[model samples]
Target chain A: MEERKAIVEIKNVNKIFGENHVVHDLDLTIYKGEFLTMLGPSGCGKTTILRMIGGFEEPTGGQILVEGERVEDKEPFERNVNTVFQSYALFPHMNIWNNVAYGLKMKKVKKEEISRQVAEMLQLVRLNGFEKRYPSQLSGGQKQRVAIARALINRPKVLLLDEPLGALDLKLRKEMQLELKNLQKKLGITFVYVTHDQEEALTMSDRIAVMNQGYLDQLDTPERVYEKPATKFVADFIGESNIFEATISHMTGDTASIGLEVGNALCLLEKGVSYSLSEMVYACVRPEKVLFSAGEAEGFNIKGVVKEQIYVGNIIKSNIIIANGQMVILSRLDIDEVPKVGEAVNIYWNPDDVVLMKSRGYQIHHVIENASLGGD
Target chain B: MKRSYRARNKTIPLLTTVSPVAIWLILLVAAPLLYVLFLSFLSTDGYNVVFLFTLDNYKNLFNPTYLEIYANSFLIAFFTTAICILVGYPFAYHMARAGKRKKTVMMVMLMVPFWTNSLIRLNGWKTLLGKTGFVNTFLQNLGIIREPVEILYTRGAVLLGMVYILIPYMILPLFASIDKLDHSFLEASNDLGANKVKTFLHVTLPLTFAGIFSGSIMIFIPSLGYFFVSDIMGGGKSQLIGNLIETQFKAGNNWPFGASLSMMLIFLILIMVTVYKKSGGDMEDLGVM
Candidate 1:
C-alpha cells in the first residue's frame, strides 16, 4: 500500500453501557479512501465503535478525530459523516426520491440541484425509476442499494455501514459484496464497515480489523490476517486452525523446536523475538496447509489414521487422529488422493506454515469448540 | 379449484375470529344508528313525537339559532384540538422517549386523572375557578384584586374544561405512535445531516402523524358531545351542539329535533373520520404499544 493519510482517528476510546464495558481502551486509525472492516462476533463492540464515529454514541472516554477535528462531543449531523444503518432505516413515510434527497434538502441546497442530484444518485444505485415507491415496495437488495445511495448522496467524508447486507440472502450477499467494493473504489470514500461475518470482511475490506471481547486483536491486510494472525483469538476467528499446545524445547537461530503431543515440531520464529528455554507456547497451522504423504516421505515421522473426509466442492476436509488420540484437521484438494478412513497416513507441515505465539492462558481448542455460540 | 378448496377450509377459522365483533356492531351499533336515522325524519309536536315522515326537523337544523350553536361547537372543538396538540404533543413525545423510570412516572401522571370519574374531576376544576374558589380567593388575599373574579360560565372556561377532559385522548395516540416509531429512522435522519429539529419535522413528525390524527379524532369528537363538561364548567352559558341536543331532549320535549341534530353531528364525524383513515391514520399506531 502507498503512504496513506488518516481520515478518522480514534484514540483510547471506551464505551460503557450500563454495567457492560462494550468497548475497552481502543486505538485505531482509518485511512482515507480505504474500505476497512471491523470484523468480530456479536458483542465485540464493532457496531459501538461505528456508532461512536457516526456520533450516535459518545465514548465514555477518549477522543475521536475525523479530519483532524474533535467530534466525540458533536451530534451526528454536526459532523459530515453519514451512516447506512443495519436495518436500512429508510423513512417509511417518504418515497425513494425524498429518502435519497433528505440530506440535500436538510442542507437547504437549491431545489433544482436536489432534483438533479437525486436523479443522478438513483441512477447510480440502479433504482432510477423507483423514486415514487416506498421502502416497503422494494426488495431487500434494492433497499440496500437505496440505503447506500441515500448516504452517498450526502458526500460524507466517511461512510459508516453497520452490517448493510446482513439481511440479504446468500447469493445476493455475494453480489453485494463485490458491488460495494467496486462502489467504494469508484467513489473513493472512506468506508468503515462492521460485520460478524468473517468472509464478508475478507472479501470486501482492503484491510480487516479483527476484534474479540471489546479488544481490537489485529488490524492488517486480509492476506496477512489470514496467514499471520497476531493473537490467538484472531487466529480462532478468521478461519479454521489446528492449534497444538506445545513447549519450546530449544531455539536454533530463527527456528523454535516445539514438542507436540504427537511428536517434535519445528516452527519458524518471527524476527526480533527471543524465546526462553522450555517456554510454553502454541503452534497453529491452517488445515489446508498440512500435507498428507502417501508413503513414508523424508523427515515425515508423525502418523495418524484417516478419520473423516468431508467433500466440499474441490476441497476435501479430513480429520486425522494420531496414535495418542489427538485429532488434527487437514484440508486437501479432491485431486490429491488421500487414504480412506481407518487407513494409516503420515502428515507434516513446513516450519513456515506453523504460527508460534506465547500462550494467552486459555485453551485455544475450548474457544474453537464454543466459537459458533457467537456474541451475546 | 385449489384456491376455492383452500378458501372453504379457511372459512371456519375466519368466521370464528370475526363473527363476535360483527354481531356486536350489527345488533348494538347499526341498530341504534338506523333508529336514529328513522327518528330524524319523523315529525314532532311541541308535546309528543309522531312517527310521521316530515322535513321539518331537518329544516330546523338550518335555523340561525342552531347555526350559531353549530359554529360555536366547531370553533371550540377546533381550538380544543389545537391546544391539545400544542401541549399534549410535546408531553407525549418527551414521555415516550424518556428513560424507563421517567417514562413510567409521566405515564402515571397522564393517567391519574382517568382514575376518577371525569364529571367528578370537572367538578373539582369548577371549585378552582368558581367565585370565592381557590384561585379567586388566593388572588384577593394577595392584594392582586379587590374583588373575586368571575371565571366560570364563560367561553374560555368551557374551552378549558374541554381541553382538560380531552387532552388524555390526544396524548395516548401520540405516545403510542411515537413509541412505536422505528428508533433507527431518527438516527438515520440525524446521520444524514439533519439536526434534531429538522429530523423531527422531516421524519419524526411525519411518522407519528398517525398518532396525532387519531388523537385529534379521539379528542375533537368527544369534546363536541361532552355536555356535562360544558354544563358544569360553563354553567350552560356557552351552549354547544351537545347542550342544544340535551335541552331538546329534556326541557324542550322535542325528541325528533334532537335526533336530527345527532344525525347531523354523526355525519360530520363520519366525514372527519373517513378523511383520517384515508390519510394513513392507523389506530394501531395510536400508542397501542
Candidate 2:
C-alpha cells in the first residue's frame, strides 16, 4: 500500500498466434515492489502477459515500458527482467551452483564473486549445501527453489513467474506461496506472477488481475475482487457463488427490485447501481453469505426444499430447490441441528450481499457451470 | 527353505529365456573374435600360417609403410566424421524444430537412400561424380566450364562418399537428443541475460552433447572399417587400413597379419566405447554406451 510510481506499464498489448488470439488489448500498470498476480483459467492469457513482460513474447500491436523505457523490441536478455519458468527449466547438465550463477557467468562476473553471490542466493532460497547436485537429483520443490534463486541472482528490476509452483503438491504449494510473498517483499522488486489458482493469487498478490478468454475481466485488490466482482465471470471464478438469471422489474431511487427468473420472487438490489425497468440482469450471492432460516428474516428471503446435504468436514454444503425447481447452494456451519433432505427451508441473504450486474448473454451461465464442474 | 526354493525356481525360467541369446552371441560373435585373436599370435609365411607362436605380426604393424596407411585411415575417418557433424547438426536441429508433418517427411527423405543397398548407393555416387558424370555434363552444357572435369576417383570423392552414407547415422541420434531437449531451458537461458549464441553454447550445445558424441562415434567407427566406399571412389589412389588388411588376406595371403590388424581396430573401438561409458553415457540413453 505504499505510494510508489508505476515500474512497468503495458499499453494495449495484443498477442495473436496464427488464427488464435491469445491476448487482447491488455492495459495494465504494476507499481514498484508490488506482487501483482495475473489470475485466470488455463487459456486466459495470464502466462502470455507475463511472457510479454519477460520479453519471451512480443506484443502484436502495443508497447511495453519497463522502467519508463519501451521494451517491445528488446530480447529477453536485453531487458532488465527475468522469468522463472513453470517447469523450473534448470539446466540438467549443470550443478546447482552453476545453474544459479548462469546469468552472472554470462555477464562475465568474476569467478569468486559469482561463487559468493550464488552461495548467498542458495542460502536465501533455503537451499544451502545443494550446489553440487544436478537438477535431476533435486525434488520438485527444490528444483523450484533453484529456479527462483537462478532468476533472482540476476537482480533484474522485474521478476516474472509463470505458475512456478504449479507442479508442487497442494501442501508444498501453500508453503511456497508464503515463501515467494516474503521473498518479493524482502527484495523490494516488482514481481509479475501468473497462476490459474485463485487461492494463490488471493494469498500473495497486492493486486490481482482476473482474466477470462484473453480479456481482462477485473483488476483490483483480492478482497474487492472477491466481494465486489465486476462481472459474472469474476464472481464465478474467484469463489463459490449462487448465480442466476433475473430481470429488473422496478426501481425506487437507488434500489432496483429484481424478479428472479426461476422463482419469480422479488428482491431488492442493495449494493449496485439501479438498472432500468424490465432490463435483464444477473443476480449473485456468495454461498457463505446466505443464511437459512425456518421463518422470515430482515432481508431478501426465498423458500426452497432441501434437495441434498453434503458433510464436507467442518462445513455442511446443502443444495436447495425453490418451489419453481431452481437450485440455490448454501454452506452453513453455525447451526447445530442439521437439515434433513426434502425439508422445506427459507434462505435469507442480506440486501447488501446480493450483487446485481447486467446479464452477459446465455453462455455465461454455461461457462460457469462447466468451470465449477471441474473442482477447484 | 521354501523361499530359497522359490527364488531358485524364478532363476530357472530367467536362465531358460536368456540362454538362447547367450549361445548365439558365443557361437556367432565371440567364436570368430577369439579365432582372430588366436591367429594374430601366429606367424605367417607368404602362402600360409606357420602355426608357430610369434609376435612378428604386431611388430610388423609398426613398420612405417603400414603406419602411413593407419594414419591416412584415421585422417580420412576424422574428416568424414567432422564433415558429417558440421552438415548434419543444423539439418537435424531444423528437423527437430519443424512441425510434425514436415518432420515425418524429412525423416523419410533421409531414409530413402537406405532402401537401395549402400553398395549400390556408393556406386550411384561414383557414377555421378565420374569425369563425364551428371555434374560435369551439366556444368559443361551450362557453359560454366569448357571441358569435363575429373570428379570421381579422388580423395574428395572418397570423403564425399563416406560422409554421404554416414550422414544419416549422425543425423538420427542428433534428432533424437535435440528433439528431447527441454525448450524451457533455452528460454530460461535467454531470460538470464544470454543472447541466442550464448544460449546455444551454454544450454543447447551442452545438453545435446550426448547426441553429438554418439553420432560422431557412429560415423567414425564405420568410416574407419568400411573401405568399399574408398575402393569404389578413391580409384586405388587412397589406401586405408581396411584395404591394407584386405590385401594382406587375399593378394598377400598373410592371414596372421590381417588378423592382427583387425584385432588392433577392435581394441581401439573398445577403448573409445569405454571412454564414452565413463563420461556418463548409459546404454539406455542410445544403446551406444
Candidate 3:
C-alpha cells in the first residue's frame, strides 16, 4: 500500500537531555484528521515527542514537517499547533472567556470575532454560561474541558494533548476520552495525543504507536496493535498476555508447529519470516483465549494446578502452575464458571490464537506466572 | 457512669501554642503602635509638657512649608521605588531563572551589599560623587570635564542612595515570586501562539504583580521616613519630609508637630494598603514560593 500523505511528519528526531537520550531516532507520520496516540510507560519520551511536534522543544537531530513545510527552527508560537497540557495550565488570572480567547487575541483577531469564537468554543466544550467563572471556580473535569476548548479555539492544523485527562477520576477520564475522540472526528483535526494508559490509547486513537524505552515498538490500528503486535515489547505493554517458551518444530505455509516443554503446540505466523526449524521462540496468547477443562481430554493440552483464582467482576482470572513448576499459565474464565483454587485442570488453546515471535534473551513466562500468583 | 463522665470532661493543653506569639505581638508591635498614637495626640510647648488635647499639630501639617516637604518626600520615595522595581525585576528574574550555582552566586552578590551599614554605604557614595572624588578625578583625567562636576548635595544623589540601599529588599521578594512560577504555564502560553513579549506581558507580569506591589510598598514606606541618606549624600542641602520631621522634633523643638507628621504618614500608608486590598489582588497568587 502507498504511504499515507502526512499532515505532520517527524523524521529521525532525536532529543538528548545532558547525557540521557530521551527520544532517539524517532520517525512518525501523522495523517490528516487522524487521532494518533503515543502510548508508553513513564519516561518513555511520549510527552517529548508530542512537545517536539508542537515546537516546544527543538530536536537535537532530524526534521519536522508540518503541512509539508520544514518547521524545525520555528518557535512554538510560529508553528500552527497548540497543546493541552496534563495540568491544563489554564491561566488562573483569566476567566473562562478570556482563557478561551487568549490564542485568538494573540493573533489580533477582531474583538467581535474573538467573542464569537470563544462563545462557540465554550459551547463546544459544553461550558456555556461559564464564561465569567475563573479556572479556580471550575471542577477538574470542567477545567479539562476548558483546556480542550482553549486549544481547539486556536484552530491549528494539529492539536497536541499530553495526558489531558490524567488528573480526573476514572469515570470522568473515560468520558472525556470518548468526548475528545468524538470532538476530533467532528472537527476533522489532526490530534497527536500522549498517554501512558494503554486502554485510553486503544479506546480513542485511530492508530496507536506503542513506545518502550524511547523507541517506537509498533504503529498500527488499535485492533492490529492489540491482536497482532509487531514486537514482544508491544505485546507485553498493550494488554495482558500469556507468553510461553517454545522451539519451532516445523513450518508449513502460514502455520508453524512449536515444541513446548508441556507438549507440541501449533502457532500461526501472520507476518514474520525470520524463523527456522528448532529455533527457540516465544508464543503469546491472550488470557481470554486459554480454555480450562473439567476433565483431561484434549489433542494438545498442558496439565496444571490452579494456584490462585481472582474474581474480577466480569471475568475470573486463574493462575495455573504447569508441570515445569517454574512456568505458569494465566487463564481467564467467565465469572459464571469460576474455578476453585488448588484444583488440577487442563489448559488448552487453539493454534490460531497463539502469536509466535523470535524470543529475545529472556523469557517472560515465569514473570507473568509470578505476577498472577502474587509472588514477589 | 465512669466512662460517660470521662467522655464528657476534657482539658485544654497547659501551654497553648499561640501564647508566645501573642505575647511577642503585644510587646513588639501593639505596644509601640499604641504609644506612637498616644504621643501623636499629646501637645507640648517648649521645654514644658502641656498635656492638652489640641488639633494644632494636625492643623500645622497642612501648612504649605510642611506640606511641600511631605510631597517632596512622597515624590522621592515613589521615584526610588519605581527605579528599584525597574532594576530589581530583571535582576530577580535572572536570579530566579538561573541555574543552582549561578542563582546562589547572584543571591550572595545581591545580599553582600546589604551586609554593610547603610550609613557607611551612604558616606561611600558621597565620597564617590564629591567634587574631588574618584568619578570627577577619572572624568578630569580622561579630559571629559575641565572642572569637577557637582553631583553630591543633589537630589539625584539622594535618590540613588535610597535606590541602592532598598534594591535587595525588592529583589528578594520578587525573586521568590518569579521562582515559583510554573514553567509549564509559560510553555503552554508559547504553544498557544503567544510571542515572548506577549507572554511576558499577559502572563508573567500580572502573575508577579503581588510581589511587585509588596516590594514597592516595602521600599516606598521606609524611604519616606529615611533622613540619613539624604542628609549625608545630599550634603544637607536637600530637605525631605524625614529631615523636616527630624528638625521639628530634635532641632526645632516641635515634638507635637513631628508626631502629627508621623501620624499623617501612617494614614497615607493605610490608604495605600486599603487600595491594594480593595483591588482584589491576592499576594499568595503572585507565585511566591
Question: Alpha-carbon error at A195 in model 2, in Å?
Answer: 0.9
The better-scoring model by DockQ among 2 and 3 is: 2
Better of 2 and 3 by TM-score: 3
Instruction: Give the CA lDDT, 0 to 100, for residue A345 in model 3.
Output: 78
Taking chain A of candidate 1, what TM-score results?
A: 0.93
Task: Name model 3 segments beyond 4 Å from true.
Answer: A1-3, A249-264, A294-301, A323-336, A362-376, B1-16, B283-289
Candidate 2 — what's its lDDT?
0.87
Per-candidate count of clashing residue pairs (backbone under 3 Å): 1, 0, 1
User: What C-alpha lDDT do the candidate models reach, one value each?
Assistant: 0.89, 0.87, 0.84
Off by over 4 Å in 2: A1-3, A264-272, A296-301, A323-327, A334-338, A362-376, B1-60, B134-150
lDDT of 1: 0.89
Candidate 2, residue A214: lDDT: 96
Candidate 2's residue-wise lDDT over A1-376, tens digit each? Answer: 5578988999999999999999999999998888999999999999989988988888999989999999999999889899999999999999999999999999999999998999899999999999899999999999999999999999988999999999999999999999999999999989999999999999999999999999998999999999888899999999889887887766766555667754443455644454556667887889887777788664345788899988888888889998677778888784655567888888767667777777755455456556856556
Give the least accurate 10-residue stretch of model 3 chain B, judged by summed lDDT: B7-16
lDDT of 1 at A165: 89
Among residues 3 or more apart in sequence or in different chains, the pairs in candidate 2 whose N, CA or C atoms overlap within 3 Å are: none
TM-score of chain B of each: 0.89, 0.94, 0.90
Put down candidate 2 lDDT per residue, B52-88, tens digits, no spaces: 9999889998998877888888999999999999999
Over the stretch A8-106, how does candidate 1's per-residue lDDT look in tens digits? 999999999999999999999999999999999999999999999999899999999999999998989888788999999989889999999998998
lDDT of 3 at B260: 81
By DockQ, the candidates rank as 2, 3, 1
